[model samples]
Target: MDTPALIADDLVVLRGGRKTVDGASLTVAPGEIYALLGGNGAGKSTTLFAILGLIKRSSGVIQVAGHDPEVAPDAVRAAAAYLPENVALYDHLSALENIRYFLGLAGQTRTGAELDQAFDAVKLAPAARTRRVSGFSKGMRQKTAIALALLRQTPVLLLDEPTSGLDPAAARDFHDLLIDLRKRRVATLMVTHDLFGAADTADRIGVLQGGRIAQEWTAAAQGPRFDIQALHQSYAGPDAA
Candidate 1:
């Protein structure tokens, strides 16, 4: 198997003297999507932040594309694209403008044609490319952000609540975009509460409970990828189930 694009080994993160992520470990292989599923305060987002080097890990190891985020944050970030729960784009700027601005910030430059191509890859409407993002729907904003990620050519993607706020049709389109990214060998690690979305999109799903990985499930070769009922029981806790 290829070296994992992302790795968190015995990961631990603390906030205010409490362990937010305690010994949570997982991996995302190139061209694979791994969904980290949990409810509120389950340390899912904390795990993502630790990988991004935004939050210092109390202990354990983290490697993004062979670079340690704590040791070489710049290199780690360069090799990864992160989309937070709320994609931050200048509402006043058009989609192309937003992409251009971010690329410039990254010290990378792309021509007009390349920018358009990225937008096309994400299936953002041609007409919307030149309009202010303030008028765009949540899905449109997500597409614009993803286009920026594509232009960066990042090998890994970290997404937090990627499918939240999207309608069924828009979510499906977003999943298709993820499939294309997988085909391009981008390893994706997404944290979400969307069980249905995770079941439909992820090659593997890890359940995070009480700040640790409680259990995990992998997709099957044929038929349904998951037993939704079982997955739900795991996610909702035995009492809730």
Candidate 2:
């Protein structure tokens, strides 16, 4: 088997003495799109945060792009880009400005032409390129964030609730964008509540319930039998219940 691009072993998190993520363990290989699915309060966000070094893992080992965040944050972060459900962009900054700014933070220095191409690749509207994000819609903001990620050219992507509050049309577009990223061989970890999105986009799915993955759904044939319903029910294993 190919070596995993990301790995988590005995991932644990605590908030007010509650074990939110209890002993979650998994490995994600290169070019694989993995979805972390669960209902609210299931610790999906917590897991992503821990992996990104946003919230320290109380007692777990997580390797992102062959680097340990606890021991080497800069190296791990350099290989990954994070897009949370609610991206925090400067409302006063134009999309291009936002992309340019964050790219700099990632130690990236792209020329204007390169930056523009990144925006176009993510399908951000050229018409909205110069407009401040203050008035842009959620979808527009997300596209800007994606542009930043693309420009950074990270190997691993970590997203939390990526499709929340998006209209069907916008959400569909987002799904397509993710598919395109996979074609480019970027390993993706999507924390999503949208089961339909999970069924369509992810190569594999894991349900995070009770602090452990109840079961794993490996890649199925590409026909209509991706088994969306089976995945839904599989989340509720005897242990999960």
Index of the highest-lDDT prediction: 1
Q: What is every candidate's alpha-carbon RMSD to the true fold? A: 1.1, 2.4
TM-score of each: 0.97, 0.93
Model 1 collision count: 0
Model 2 C-alpha RMSD to native:
2.4
Locate the minimum summed-lDDT window of 10 residues in model 2. 232-241
* Model 1 lDDT per residue over 1-241, tens place: 9899999999999999999999999999999999999889989989999999999999999999999999999999999999998999999999988988999999999988988888888889899999999999999999999999999999999999998999999899889888899999999998998898889999999999888899999999999999999999888977755
- Give Cα distance to truth, residue 137, candidate 2, Å: 0.3
Model 2 per-residue lDDT tens digits across residues 162-217: 89999999899899999999888899999998888888899888888898787778
Which lDDT value does model 2 have at 162?
87
User: Per-residue lDDT for 233 in model 2?
Assistant: 64
